[model samples]
Target chain A: AQSVAQPEDQVNVAEGNPLTVKCTYSVSGNPYLFWYVQYPNRGLQFLLKYITGDNLVKGSYGFEAEFNKSQTSFHLKKPSALVSDSALYFCAVRFRPGYSSASKIIFGSGTRLSIRP
Target chain B: EPEVTQTPSHQVTQMGQEVILRCVPISNHLYFYWYRQILGQKVEFLVSFYNNEISEKSEIFDDQFSVERPDGSNFTLKIRSTKLEDSAMYFCASTPPGHSTNNEQFFGPGTRLTVL
Candidate 1:
């Protein structure tokens, strides 16, 4: 079965420091990787996706992700962390079975990223 | 920007009772989907609808769960009989018509269902 994994349950970084939220996937065929962030009491916001282009994908809120095919990892990153960037981050992979035209998103357990002053 | 919208941010229901969660996808979107996250759990896909029919569903989307696009603008998920385990944050999503791998789904804020 296809699945996503976020090794860290929580990641803490000092404000203005760089941050990384790790993610890896187990799936067959080429994978469509995505990053989503959820704020308290808010819906999941799409951050970025790696479809077929460059290994580095940029997204909203100054967030970016690096898609590494050899390792099957798509890690979310930011050059400088902000308090407002603290939220739950999820890594997801879109999978479509060989026989099915419809695809479903398999999400990681999620990692809570906290930025402290 | 156009975004998916869900009704009733929260809903409380009793076990064995029926409940319907409503959503209005972006006007131009043709693919709709429902996903749920149990508190502290990964988000799980329930079902996907397209061309006015269910295109796919997950194992968790048992007979008790059904989805429909009742009108031009409203898509709904009806749980025939709610169970305590059904308590979750249900999210509705949609994307412009395209191959599944190419379209990125836009998600709604989600409805928190509390089954007692």
Candidate 2:
């Protein structure tokens, strides 16, 4: 089956420092990658996505991600971390349904990002 | 900004009871979807609806579950028989048709279903 893996159970970063949450996927054909975040008691929020363009994809709240095809990775990154950035991060991949169906989106286990003040 | 909205932020139901979760996606969106996340697990896709019909569904979306776009504004998920294991947070999401740069699924606050 197609899936993405988030190796880190949790990532700790001091406020003002850069942060990274790793992700890698295994899927056939071109993949559509996305990053989502969930706050305590809140729904998942869209962060960024990588469709078919440049390797660098930037998203909400000063967040960004790098798509490395050869490495089969799409890691979420932020130049500087804020305490507010602490949340549960998820990496997702959408399996494009050929020409007759809706896309099935798959999510990674999740990475807890704790940004310290 | 227009966003998806869901009813009954939290729901408590007895096992074997039927439950319906309601969602109102953005007025202009063309695609609707349902996803659930058990406490510490990944969010799993349940089904996708478009043009008043189901576009796709996953294995978990068995006969027990059904979706209906009752009107122009509401899309609902009905679980015929709720089970204790069905407790989770259910999210409703929607996205536009085609692959536009803005074609990202917008999600609602989600309804937490607790079956006892």
Candidate 3:
């Protein structure tokens, strides 16, 4: 079985400061990691993903995540946090395709991020 | 870029009544999916559809739930009998071909179903 864990329930950071939301996973095979952001009353928005490439992956809204295989982690990061970036962040891991796109991904419990002015 | 869309931004129905949530996937996507998130809870996958058939479903998807691609552009999820626990935000998503985490899904704004 594959699973993801977001250790923090919420993170608070000052606007213009760097922010990092921690995520770690447990998977039998190579892990496929992803980050998504959700705002009030909206659907999950894709941020970035780590399939197979450089350790760091950049995503929408100037957000990025680094896939650290040794640590079994994919941490989302933003150098300068914006008040607009405040939202619920989710860490997801891809399931084996098994020749189909069904059961594509499983999400973490989610971490709420707040940017303080 | 074209985006996925869902109908009835909010739906309120009495318990035991049947309701169908609709979705229009991106024109070029090959895979479609439905997920639900209970109030203040994690988002949960319900089912996935492709080639006009169900490709996968989570344990939460029981006999009361069904999915159909009635038309080329529309995909629907039907709940035969609603329960109070079923009240939540339902999301619809779509993905293009060539699977991987990188093949990101486009999600609709979502439908908020309130079962009473």
- Which DockQ-derived CAPRI band holds candidate 2? medium
Runs in model 1 deviating more than 4 A are none
Q: Model 2: per-residue lDDT, tens digit, A1-117?
A: 789999999999999999999999998888889999999999889999999899999999999999999999999999999999999999999875655346667899999999989
Per-residue lDDT of B60 in model 2: 93
Tens digits of per-residue lDDT for model 2, B1-116:
88899999999999999999999999988888999999998899999887888888889999999999998899999999999989999999998778522367888999999999
Scoring model 1 with DockQ, what do you get?
0.77
Clashing pairs in 2: none
- Worst window of 10 by summed lDDT in candidate 3 chain A: A96-105
Q: RMSD, each candidate, Å?
A: 1.0, 1.4, 1.2
The CAPRI category of model 3 is medium
> What is the lDDT for A29 in model 3?
79
Residue B100 CA error for candidate 2 (Å)?
8.3
- Residues B16-105, candidate 3: write the lDDT tens digits: 999999999999888889999998988898988888898888899999999999879999999999999999999999988776345887
DockQ, each predicted model: 0.77, 0.57, 0.67
Residues A1-117, candidate 3: write the lDDT tens digits: 889999999999999999999999999877888899999988999998888879999999999999998899999999999999999999999775676655477899999999999
Ranking by TM-score: 1, 3, 2
Reference-based lDDT, each prediction: 0.92, 0.91, 0.91
Best by lDDT: 1
